[model samples]
Target chain A: MSRTRVLVVGAVLVIFFVAGGILIYVNGHQGGQNLTFNVTVTGATTMKPDTLPAHQNDTVTVNITSDTDGEVHLHEYDIAFDTRAGQMVSHTFKADKTCSCDIEWESTGHPLGTLVVSP
Target chain B: MTLAAQILLHGFGPRYDLPIATALYLYAAGGVVFISFVLVVLFAGDRVGPNATEYPRRAVSWLVPIARSPWPRIVGGTVGLIGFLTVVVAGFFGSTNAFYNPAEYVVWIYFWALMVILSGLLGNLWYLFSPWTAIYDALARVVRIEPVWKLPDVGVWPATAAYFSFACLELTTGMANRPAIVAIAAIVYTVITLAGMFLFGREEWLEHCEAFTILFGIVARFGPLETDRDEGGKISAVYVRPWGVGLLKPAPSGWDRVLFVILMLSTLAFDGISATPAWQDFTVALKGYWLPLGAFGLFAVRTFGLILLTVAFLLIFITFMEAVIYLGQRKVDLKATVSSFALTLVPIALVYNAAHNFSYVVVSSQYLIPLLNDPLQKGWHLWPAVASFTPNFALAQASTVWYADIVLIVLGHVIAVFLSHLRAGERFRTAQRALLSQYPMLLLMVLYTMTSLWILAQPITRES
Candidate 1:
């Protein structure tokens, strides 16, 4: 009985390991979707919609209009674009990395919002 | 400065782990519950009394002579001293910009994040290269140093207090990322440590009062390598055992020690929770109440939250310990059982630290490459190749980090359950009593496991 118990436990663990690996691989490699957002920096650093979401491997584009002259810097992916006061600027990049990365005002280092790319 | 340079200096900016998929989270949680049940089914009836504290250790006698030699100490001490001095000097005299300053990266990323993970995986390397001990040992060689005063018998409470203060510095004060503040804190800590050693003996102060010394020592128990001392208190032999087995050794018993262990877990969890949107909302809601104090209000709110979280952890753990004692129907001392069992929970802390900081460490430590080329920010091309190298953010992709986080969390709880069972066996004697006592412990592990995963899945946000 003890020997049988050991075998059963060992088998269960192996099954769990294999299944978990396959599930993670499949979940991670899902196809991407194109996403776009129009973010307005109305106050010195406040973003209209402070949080942007996208799927992993998605093509992400952001159109920005700011009240002040500063650059919008997206962290992790290291994408950046300059915005003049009252002028619209657009930047595009593939969200290949999955992270809830901060979008910040480059000069003041104030966080404007977050761009979350999920798997 | 360029926008890139500004982003680089903003080292304390929001770092959010890619939240794990809900499906994966559910799978991992179910796996934890199922694994605990399987552990009981397989090992529940095995009775091993006092021998439960015993695990196999193989001594490498060939390495003993080399390990005891002065060469390792000299090289390790010199490197440690250089690293410490670099942080202090760069912090004080170097560029105010943290991008070029090595102080912030060395302290926050390298020492706090990286070294902690290394100690958990590779034994107590910190013991070999701790700058404070290295400096003391070097000084002792030149001058005869002895204790002027005996340290009071406080049972690690001083270290606990020191650690709590350090945690506040890292998590609450927001000063760790500033070069001048980091320098001042280092100089002040250095004076306190050296003064303590001058009054009390070196070993006594380190063992009872020094925060990192106690912390790294606890974390190193999960590592595979261990040392055995001779009658004269020198390392006589080096042994290699299985990871997580060193925790089964008889733990030093005290309420202070228990609180220290709980603090380790609570502080780590709090760091993760503080970054979540929910915690951000909670803090923002309470901000109005303390609005009169201005800037200090945010700091006070965070510190209060940290203390409250710690107290909640302690209360919950104690209640669970009582449940275990009551259900076991054995005449066990609550204090003794609680203290011994507290060490078993450390695996969870270790993995949580590693999992939560996985991407942060990977991405942040890369800054060291460029910093190494021009650590003082004088624009000297000391190593041009390294200075021009770009950081590889793609190394920690969201899907990959999520899998790593879930696996680490699950593995940690499984180990915790195993350690708790062994501890219960030591206390309860009979296999049945031991198994019964662990029911409460198993529940606690499952609960903690879910909480860890839940924290990992929360959206990251800055504290208001």
Candidate 2:
């Protein structure tokens, strides 16, 4: 093959990866699954199951139980709830958008978890 | 299908939280961007844009007019040196909680992520604020001595290695989690920096060895204001260049610089990748395979993968560049083409970095508030009045993050396309040939753009 042809072919080769990525995107949509995630806050800085999967239209629920009295904020869904020691508080909403949002304890800047909502 | 294509598409599976919608749009928009770059290169002709307009002419006007005096240097440099020393000491002896230690926030969030973003936007403030440079300058001035040794002729290889090492330290290790390690790392880095400065003159060492110096300098090229010193050694006024126009003057040259450009992209690529579910899974899978080799084997395998990914980035870039050269019918030497066009990736790397670390910079940095209240985690309180201060992460909304992410990525990619077009125009004699030469490069940019966007949108999994 001519070098120009080879270069064109090589550029075309990249398209396969691009196409695969796009295919992944085009076929991927989230609005149907109902999911519940249990997030246990370990300390002032960490959380168990630090990430959870949700969809934009699904009834996604996050049940967070902490060892300390602090508020949990779900940033994308934009909700906050107060939690005392040893109680599992649940926040449920439409996943809204296929974007990731942080769930964190307000005071210590400790991440409670993340909600990876899909479209 | 290539192994990579299958891996990129299938590894995540349908259950994986890939940002399909975002990636799809990126693919389409990126194509449009590719065409736009082509048009700009072909028909737009030989316009070098506008000359840089100099600003207020009085940046150092407020500096108390201590021209060529050591007092200003001593005061500024000493404050920075004391701060660095304080962080090292605090790391060794302070609270074990990385969140409580000021060093974590100061180094990782403030210096690494936030300041990098600011430097890209507002120009090289970090060049002035660099702790090691300041300390070295003060020492050089006080000792009244020139550098004992000469600088190597190596083109930015030291900086590439330095930046890669810094990234590995941040990504592959838990330096932020461990204070003593942070202290040791800080000490080792300081020693190396000081020695290098002493050996190869302060300015030469910074330009060649300092990672942030190179990083902030590159990003500053895109910034509106630039500092220039004329032959008379007077403080030339800060000039406001047309957005990203300063990039046209100095493009990367030499093999080391080309590799530096590639490594710059790779390091950021690894940062984005390592944070994803896909990479976490890959590590988990590798852990099982490497378990027979024992505990250290796992670390060995992980490091191998890190190096492999970076090499893979190099391979992909050169392969594409080779194709571009072929398209241009070998008008430019391969190495020269690589150096000239590689600079176009700088803005993308900077923007991707900002997008990736947005949350960490915004929310995690909040821990600094309480840490500032008690830096040593002792009962010391410099600000007793602000003791009850609590950071609301909600202050940074999801829509806000999304806006910044998409906008910056798109803007940076467009700028990259423009930059490569401009550079190609400069390289190739004829504008038509230049436009034709960029077809492959533009395609490569689009591919990288989609990949970066997909990586950013990938769901954050638990760190393995």
Candidate 3:
């Protein structure tokens, strides 16, 4: 075979391999499920299981109970809601964007944890 | 927590991309890189392409008049000066909040991220509108400026040092988010640069000491534009060439040049690595031992990590260079071979940088839109329509970003492999020897590509 044919065949093989890989991987993550998490905020830190993981398009709800009056700010998504000292507050939204977002205490800007939405 | 610390704890913006899945994508990228190497060896074996001097270039003679006109320089220089002044003034007097401050957006996003991206894709605009160079040129007309002292024959080591420090400031200091700190740092840098230019001479200082000049110039090599010069060192023609072909021109080789290029890759890799959870945990664990140092502990730890990564990169690169030398069994000096081959790796760096900062360039740069009306944020709306402009956060979706990053990273490795094959063909002067010498480099490229993909797979940040 000529050099050009070899090069052309090599190029096609590469495209096929790369495209096949992505298609297969993406096919596995087709649907999303609703996920709810109850989080406790003590002072500036979040309780155990800090990172809340969800999938793309999943409706995620976080119930926050804090000892201090502040707001819970979910970055990237730009969603926030107020939380009173003794009352439970919940924020729910579709995990439309896939990113590892920082959930911070809105008043002090302290990081409470991460909200990872995998695609 | 201080607001600046809070704001900068994760990043300047809230646009962290989803990490690419490593299992399938990493292997796919590696396979592509390997296959590209095989294809190059099979097809391009032993034949050198036209060297830089002999590369085919069709001069656009009509552009000579436009290129020679003084209007471009005058307008470009004025704009540069205005931009520099605006950043300084706004940084010092603008709102304390980084999100509201245009200075933070201009410096970090526009200049740091966007400018580098443009320099790689287009030609280096920094060459045309570098504020410091413009300032020096303007000052030279008013006063009979002359170099007070001669610059020694140091070969870009100062630039390497300057670049290292600049990277540390961008990555480690955590002060970059503070507008006031950015202003102060910009002022300090300007002062140092002006003093260097005045004492050592403008061209000398810019070539040897200025970090961005050297950096943008290097990235511009892979761009499509080319300025051809006559034997008299005057621009004779302007032409456009294929991207990545300008790298085929034999550039001056030295250890310092090699390290500068290596740092281009290592610093970009370090940016991705530093944001990973493993790095965060390691720093936290080390903080206990450094408690006596107070707030300086984290800063010290980060600086140490940056230096460690740079050194580690240098050593790994040298080992590969040795492998090439041994495999080829050529009488070439290791240092020369290393230096020459270093330029071939630039495509990888450029693409990695583009991929890593894709979200910042697309999404974060939009913050400048609203700021255009009230740059200082005192309710002075220069453009009322812009005042209501909201950044489109979804412009860069996580899936889109992940796929773009993977494709760009793989493409960059392929380009690098092709360039190295050409370089080997030229250097070894025999097809068999050139093909043999490339095994180590091909392996190195595959490994580096995998590492790049792996970094993308890791979470952007996980606060242990």
Candidate 4:
């Protein structure tokens, strides 16, 4: 192929990739199912999966049940609420943006898991 | 963190990591860059393109006023000095809260990310506005500080050391997040920089020991603007040119320079890796045992890991260079190959920096105004009323970051391939031999592209 044709082909490929990325993002956000993660902490030991993935605008429900009362803070989402012992704290929110933030216990600096929300 | 790593970990955009998007982007970007490179080698590999480094200058005389006058530097330097002082004061006396402190944003986002970005885009604005340089310039005018002592013969090695050392501190200690530490570090750095200035002439110290100068100087080659000094010691015309043309010039021909470029990529690579779930798990598991060495032990382990990674990268790069030598059947030493190909890697580092931090800077920059209004948290609201104002994170969506990253990374690799192709063609005197040499480099570029995409695809601070 000529250099000019080759260059033109390269440009088209770029546009294709860009459009593909946008399409995935849009599809991820358009009315996805409500995703829930069941997290249980027993005396500082994690007995649950560490990462839960959700789409942007999808309802992300983290049901935290602990033997000891502690607070969980989502770093990127910048939201935190208290949890009580023997009581399940279901913190449900809209998954916004692509973020993989470390969820931490405010009292002990123990990282619980990750909230992976993507657009 | 060294500013780079922190921005990567705290990357703004999307709520979750998009593994699918990451995979698609990587496959597409890598495929396009690789195919384009092979085609270019086949069709146009024999000769230099129109934008070759030796091309004639097209004069735009209107830039004469700005280029001739030193006012831009003087004004910029003055503003930089004042701003530096504010950050220092804010770090020392401002609120302990990092979010409320202007110094945090100033140090990490503005000076760290923006400076590196601007250098790649606008040709080393640091030279015109470095607070350290401005201070030394003022002192030199009165003191007549000559290069009295014999300066170190090391070229860019000192900068590499300084960059890594600073990286260690940033990663281990909460320097970027803590106002007090940032302030103290700034003071210590200023004193040492000034002392180095007095020992060796200001120009010599800046050229040698200063990390930002050496870094910005290299990346400026890939930028659109090319500024040089005339024999009269006056800043020459702001030569406007196409991107990547400056990379063609045969400057920085030394082993130290090659090592410096390697270190730049290595440091950033480790930073990217350290953010991954696997690395985090290993570090966390190691930290328990390492803690016996005292409060500082875990940090030491992490820093050592960074050093080890850098060495690994160096080994891998050298092996590629050797492959190129063998493939082309050229009588060349490893050092010669390194010098010839070091400029090719500049685009990768530049794009990586942009892709890693662009969303974070664009989205998080909104915090600066509110922080600035009540910098010390003195509770005094400035008239700008930017306080209490928060930026909607939706502006820089996760999809946007992915798109920008894929485009830039693919483009950077293509440029790098083209650069190596041109240099190889020029050297071998035949396009066929040049193409033969580039097969090795092309492999390395594709690998590098895939590695970068993989890093971005992973979770930054996952609890593994």
CA-lDDT, candidates in order = 0.82, 0.66, 0.77, 0.70
lDDT of 1: 0.82
Give the DockQ-based CAPRI class for model 1.
medium
Candidate 1 per-residue C-alpha lDDT over A1-119 given as tens digits, one digit per residue, 9 for 90 to 100: 25676577668777887788888888766637778899899665799899998887889889999988878888877777788999999988898777778888887777778888877
Candidate 2 per-residue lDDT, tens place, A1-119, comes to: 13454354346435634564456545556367788888787564567888887655788777888887777777645587688889998987877555556666766545556677655
Clashes of 3: 2
> Comparing 2 and 3 by DockQ, which wins?
3
Q: Comparing candidate 1 with candidate 4, which one achieves the higher lDDT? A: 1
Tens digit per residue, CA lDDT, model 1, B26-114: 89889989998988877787744887767778998987887899888788778778878988999998877766678877887888888
> Judged by lDDT, which candidate is best?
1
| Model 3 global lDDT (CA atoms, 0 to 1) | 0.77
lDDT of candidate 4 over B324-359, digit per residue (tens): 777777675567667768788788877887887766
- After best superposition, candidate 3 residue A69: deviation in angstroms? 1.7
Please tell me how candidate 3 rates in CAPRI terms. Answer: acceptable
Local accuracy of candidate 3 as per-residue lDDT tens digits, B1-464: 11314534223555467777655565567666656656664644446424412445667788777677766777777877887887799989998778888787777787888888888887877877788988888888899888999999998999999998888777777777778888888889999999999999999999989999999988888887788778987778888876777777767778999999989888888888887877878787887775678878667887888788889888888899888878776688777779878888899888888888898788777878888888887879699888777667574766677767767887788778777877787777677777788888888887787778887787766433
TM-score value, chain A, candidate 4: 0.73
- Local accuracy of candidate 3 as per-residue lDDT tens digits, A51-105: 8988888999889888888787878777775888878899889988777787888
Residue pairs with backbone atoms closer than 3 Å in model 1 (clashes): none
Which candidate should be chosen as best, given TM-score against the real structure?
Answer: 1
Q: After superposition, how far is residue B111 of candidate 3 from its true place, in Å?
A: 1.1
Per-candidate total of colliding backbone pairs: 0, 3, 2, 11
Model 2 TM-score on a 0 to 1 scale: 0.75
DockQ of each: 0.49, 0.08, 0.39, 0.37
Looking at candidate 4 chain B, the ten consecutive residues that score lowest on lDDT are: B1-10
By lDDT, the candidates rank as 1, 3, 4, 2
* Candidate 2 lDDT score relative to the true structure: 0.66
